[model samples]
Target chain A: MKHTLSVLVENKPGVLARVAGLFRRRGFNIHSLAVAPTENPNLSRMTIVVDLEGKPLEQVEKQLHKLVNVLKIQDFLPHEAVERELALIKVHSTKETRAEIIQICDIFRAKIVDVSQDSLAIEVTGTEDKIDAIVSLLKPYRIIDLARTGKVAVSRGRK
Target chain B: MKLTGAEAVVKSLELLGVTDIFGIPGGATLPLTDALSRTEKIKYYLMRHEQCAAHAADAYARATGKVGVCTATSGPGATNLVTGIANAYMDSIPIVAITGQVATSVIGTDAFQEADITGITLPIVKHSYLITDANEIPYLFAEAFHIASTGRPGPVVIDLPRDVQNQVINFKFPEKVNLPGYKPTIRGHTRQIKLALEELMKSEKPVMFIGGGVVLSNAHQEVKKLAENFRIPVAWTLMGKGAFPDNHELNMGMIGMHGTRTTNTAIMNCDLLFAVGVRFDDRATGNLKRFAPHAKIVHIDIDPAEIGKNVKVDVPIVGDAAIVLRELNTMIENNNLKKTNHLAWVEQVFEWKKKWPLKTPDSTDLTPQFLISKISKAANDKDLIITTGVGQHQMWSAQFIELNGPRRFITSGGLGTMGFGLPAAIGAQVGKPNALVIDIDGDGSFQMVLQDLGTIARYNLPVKVVIINNRYLGMVRQWQELFFGKRYYAVDLEKGSPDFVKLSEAYGIKASVVSSVSELDEKIDEMINHRGPYVLDARVKEEENVFPMVPAGASLDEIIGGD
Candidate 1:
């Protein structure tokens, strides 16, 4: 099962290595990981999506709790959280298909961030599915370059 | 005095006389490593893997009596060290593993890379901790070392957070550790000792069974004095191989699965079995129902949990072996146990020793058994230490090697860990450099921690490794042949073994090979006499098995002995 874990860390050197090392040593696979600064300056939150079954995840969690640098770990379910992925897609828009690309972007609520003579770059931010849907729609226009920020997620509301 | 987690770690190294540490850097542990940067006295070893780091530390601990130290970052890194820690715990080696943790404020909130390493390691450790206060660091460090090195020593882990490491406080290493929760009883009850002596004096057929704790307690002298005073025959468990010198007139050799026929017979017939510092393991006592059927056991150990957990005892005393033995010595004189002499039993034991003397087979070629004898001769008592990996070589060492002192013969008896020899040899060598340390190991066992040769080379430790290159897991095969109708499973290792001499050469250790029995004496002499680490690969018979074997599931009487 692929599960997303949001971990708050001390934002120090070797912390990533330690986390990666633990997973590697245990033979657990991480599908995707993105670490970024949070609201707290001293703490950095990392979102890790791991493909592991029951016992190994529990074992990894237990061992992670042993590390001195890791402050907390939270497992976020897909259904409960508002997840988003930002992707920038550039399409081959030679004078002819630029208006059609703009029209499709408007339908998806995506904004045209940059325009060159031969290409149109669109920035889309939504649930991973929403971003993928827009990227698929613009695929027929001849996609030039594509980049994505892996999944970022948060729970539904404050208690 | 108060200290930060960083300085506390430094102070701990100073206390343990540790010149080096093995670990990697991480968030929670950064402050400690940063502090280490300023220290000239201690050097840090960075390992590619955290598990390897723990193994290196374990090896160091087994080689040296000092607590072997290793560190890792939070969560995964800390988790990687579990196997090595468990290995140390099983073998009862003294090690201190330090790991970084997530800060206290967000500890349970699933912080980045944070793990509950202390909780995970609690079951495997003698003691473990999570220091929230900066002032607690010094005391905890000292206590961890104390707990690790003293009594029945094992590994302890101290989890440190980034906040604890960063906190500033006046640091002074305490002269004494004052942990109220862990007070190991140093002295045994005088009354209990008196009762044990009375039991010894009254019994006509009393046998003394010793364990590894005798060596751990450094009570060989006391054990010897009591044995001589009572004139009782001594038999040992696998761990207690060297507790009593095997060459002694009263020694019946090791008593268990591969024990001598006479020892097995004596154990079954003895009226009182004085088991000291030895856990009654299953291998030692095949079927508990029939184990020591004729004898009333007197079990003495430092760990209370181990007392009733194994074989039940009529009399149990929980205290330090050395302390208990000392008290027992005094009580014996008062109770007149000294006045009683068992010349008849001594004569019987001597007769048995003569009948079942461990003699080398008449082989012109250099044999593994003969090679072990040569190693033992080179070791020559005088505080010499010997370590062995599990297999034919281990049993050969147990049978042929004479243990003149306690703790001098070190091996992983309970776990039967193959890779134990080299690392343990390192620990023993580091612990006593003046003492000649020899690892009488098998090829199968030596390969497990072959990478540790790097540690030996880096440190320039003079550890003599005698590799019995039989090219097989001799013990497993022996059992398979005897019990499983000759079905050879994964026991054979004829294919993958490196040219051992060349491998040793690659590791920068002086290497030698004795393919023939004719070359055994001279080659072993050269290897042992060399001051640096030397590996001597002695090619012995492949089919040789450790004998006088007690067929499993059979009674003690059903032993297979050489005619």
Candidate 2:
């Protein structure tokens, strides 16, 4: 099973390396990780998706909490949280195929961020499934390049 | 008061009650060294190597239960401290390591003697700091000591750049730490304690499995009270050697890969295992599937990550060992729970212990076990602090030595570093100046860090070094003899080895060599009574191996040489 953890840490140099080093040394499998500044200037929040097949969830949480910089951690269940991913996909385009690519983007609620003579760059932001679906739809147009900001999640509530 | 960062560092250390620091001076740390030399509050001991300084600091912390301090210059010097820092991390010893870094402008340029020490030590330390400004020194030093000495104590590193050290700033020590993320859970939850007590009352064959946390928390008395109050047997891990009296009737000695036959048997037969302050490492739990198969485990530790880490627990309590045990003892007393007589179980364990006593070979040549036994007998009357290098001699010392108080037996249990004994002995001796410190070392392991003999001789510390001179790396050779069909690949240490006695003499210390069993006791007594540092090289039987062996992957019950 995959576990999505939202971790709050002090905004300091090398904090990311410490967290990443711990996961590496302890042999924890990290599926995806995204870090960004939080509302507080002195703190940052990290969204990490980890594969917890053989390892215990409590142990991982405890280990993360052991790092002095880590302030808080929240393990989100799929139903109780709102999750999202963003991807920018560049597709090869011809004058004949450009109209079709724009139509697919329109259907998926995506936007054409950049356009060149031979290629069109499309940006999509949604749940992982929606991003995957739109990427698959554009695969027929010859995907020249693709980039993804891995999943970021938050619990859906006022607890 | 306005002061340079170097002066602030010295001031912070003095304010934190640090009386001594072990380190070596070099190019990068010259500024700090100059400031330290001018300060009269902290005495500095110059070490031959950064690693030895770190090990010495580690042992000093282990002996004193205070955060030990060590320092080094950048790059190579900082890199050399890795092993000792990792050793402290593995054993959970509290230490503060300060390393000098290059100037901020030249940090990324690969300047002379510059290294990203914080990045290199990220995985090993509890926390690390790379100072960006001189003002952060006071706060960082306070935080470093706080983090290093609290909640599952471990090493913390502070990397100070040369320019930062030279910069001046207003110096005022923080009245309190502002870390909101690092509060430790010191008291056990009442509901968990009640549930644990209910399980304990219901258990017929119960064993209290203790580890290093008991020693770390100074909860030896609490552990003894809980065990004796319930008529339960106590089994300890190697790190928990001195947590309970070895001569106590209920003490089951050590439990794990090299654990006693009776201790392993008792654990395997128990109905409930109450483990405190133990991580249940692989060496402690041989073949985890078969370990304590019949027991419902109740584990209590300060670190929540250790709860279900290696083995699953039925009842898990997260709290400091001393506090939790005290709470449990209070509940036990308040409930007026009648002590259940476990005569049958106690008798069964005693029978096993008597039947499978640890044996010594009946030979004219001095065996490691026999020599250790003689040392134990000779040192029986004094307050002894025993340290060891990792290998056959270490196990022999653990098995034969009688430890009655906490922090008496110090060794690298988790890391099992080869060259730990000599420097650790020095540190322990320095920490407890009144006690008799002895390093029971192996020939191979001793040769790894014998350069510290100079440190001992210079300090005139009365630390006795007993080298069990077996011609081969005896532990690895034993494994080869048993599992690898005696191929004996690179296990020999006979050739190109310095004469330890001569080496000690050259270092201006008293030295002796004992090869016969008849002279073992007399020589050990002489070494113990020596006024200053002394080395005794006792050449034991070359092929002797530690026995009642548990093959690497075998279950504890499948032990080989009991009879």
Candidate 3:
């Protein structure tokens, strides 16, 4: 099972390396990860999606909490959290495929961020599933390049 | 008053009650060394290598229960400290390692003697700091000591850039550390403690599996109280050697790989395994699936990550070992808990112990066991601190030496570093000047860091180095003999080995060599009674291997020897 953990950490150099090093050392499989500054200037929040097949999710959480920079960790169930992923898909586009690509981007509510004579860069943001669906739709037109900001998550709550 | 970062570091160390530091001066750390020399509050012992500095600091911490301090320069010097830092991390010794980093501008530019030490030590340290500004020195130093000594206790690294060290700033030591993320849980949850106690009361074949945490927390008294009050047998890990008295009837020797037959048997037979401060490591667990199969485990550890790390637990309590044990002891006393007798279980364990005693062969050639036994007897009356290099000799020392109290046996239990003993003995000797510090080492392991003999001579530290001179790397050779068809590839230490007696003499230390069993007692006495550092190379039987062996990946029932 995949576990999405929202970790709050002190904004310090090597904190991310420490966390990443731990996961590597312990052999925990990381599926996706996104880190950014939080509301507090001195703190940063990291959204890590880990595949926990061999070890328990609780153990990973406990281990993350062991790092001195890690201030807080919350494991989010799929239903209890709102997760988002952003991706930029650059497709091989010519006169024949440009209109079709724009139509597909329109259907997914994505915007054409950049357009050249032979290619189009489309930016899309949604849950991982929606992004995957759009990517599959555009795959018929050869994907020249693709980039994804793995997943960022926030718990849906007032608790 | 304004002061340079180097001065701030020295002042901060003094403020933190650090009386001694172990390190050698180098280019990157020259400024810090100058400042250290200028300060009268701290004494610096120049080590031959950065690795020895770290090991000495680790042993100092283990011996004194204080945060041991070590320093080193950038790049290779910092890299050399990795093994010792990892050793301390594994054993949970409180130590602060200060490394001089290349200037901030040169850290990533591959400048002379540049290394990202903080990055290198990220996984092993409890916390680390790379100071870019001089002002951070006071705060970082305070935080380094706080993190190293607090909660579970592990090594912490502070990487001081040369430019940052030269920057001048007003020095005012932080009054308190404000790390909101690093609060250690001291007291066990009441409900969990109650549940654990209930499990103990219900168990008929209960055993307490203790480890390094008990020693780290100074909870030996609490562990003894809990075990004796409940009539529970205590089986200790190698790191937990001195946590309980070896002579006590209830103490069932060291457990796990290279552990006693009786301890393993008791662990297998026990109904309730109350494990405190043990990680249930692979060496200790053998085949995890068959380990303590019949027991319902209640594990108490300060680090929550360790609670269910290797083995699942029925009841998990996260708290400091000493505090939790103390709380449990108090609750038992206040509630007047009935002590259940396990006479049958105790008798069964005693029978196993009597039947499968760790035996020494009837031979005139000094075996490692016989040599260690002689040393143990000679040092029995003195307050002794025993350290060992990893291998067959380490196991023999652990088996033969009877540690009566905590803080007596210090070894690289976690990392099992080969060259840990000599420098660690120096550290222990330096920490406890009056105590007899002995390094029981193998011929191969001793040769790894033999240069530290200079440190011992210069300091005039009365650390006795006893090398069990088996011609081969005995432990690996034993494995080859058993499992690898006796193809002893590259395990021999007989070729190109230095004459240790001459090496010690050159270093201005007393030295001796004993090849016969008859000379063992007299030689050990002479070494122990020596006024300064001494080295005794006792040539032991080359082919003898450590027994009561559970071959790798084998269950406890598959133990090979007990005859």
TM-score of each: 0.73, 0.98, 0.98
Model 3: colliding residue pairs: none
Instruction: Using DockQ, give the best candidate's number.
Output: 2
**Of the candidates shown, which would achieve the greatest lDDT relative to the real structure?**
2
Question: What does candidate 2's lDDT look like per residue over B437-500, in tens digits?
Answer: 9999988888899888889888888999999999888899999998899999999999999888
Count: clashes, candidate 1: 40
Candidate 3: misplaced stretches above 4 Å? none
lDDT of 1 by residue, A24-90 (tens): 7667888778888889877788888888965446557755654445777778878777777788998
Q: Write the per-residue lDDT of candidate 1 for residues B1-563, one digit (tens) a residue.
A: 66666887787677768776778788878888898888888778766567657766776665455678889999998998887788778667788999988888888888999888876775577667788877777677888888888767888898888888888778776889764335566687777776787788778889999987886777788899888887888988877777788778778888888888778888888889998888777778777788889888888888765676657788888789888988888777766645445667767877777787777667776677777777777667446788888888888898888876666777777656667787667666666778888888888988877877887788788988888888788898888998899999998888988988898889798998888867777897787679899988888888877777777767776788643
Higher-scoring candidate on lDDT, 1 or 2:
2
Q: lDDT for each of the candidates?
A: 0.79, 0.91, 0.90
- Shift of residue B283 alpha carbon in model 1, Å: 1.4
CAPRI level of candidate 3: high
Candidate 3 lDDT over A116-136, as tens digits, reads: 999999999999999999999
Q: What is the TM-score of chain B in candidate 2?
A: 0.99
Chain A TM-score for model 1, please? 0.89
Error of 3 at A147 (Å): 2.0
Global Cα lDDT for candidate 2: 0.91
lDDT per residue (tens digit) for residues B415-530 in model 3: 88999999999899889999999999988888899999999988898899999999888999999999999999999888899898998899999999999977777888889888
Q: Give the range where candidate 1 chain B is weakest over 10 consecutive residues by summed lDDT.
A: B177-186
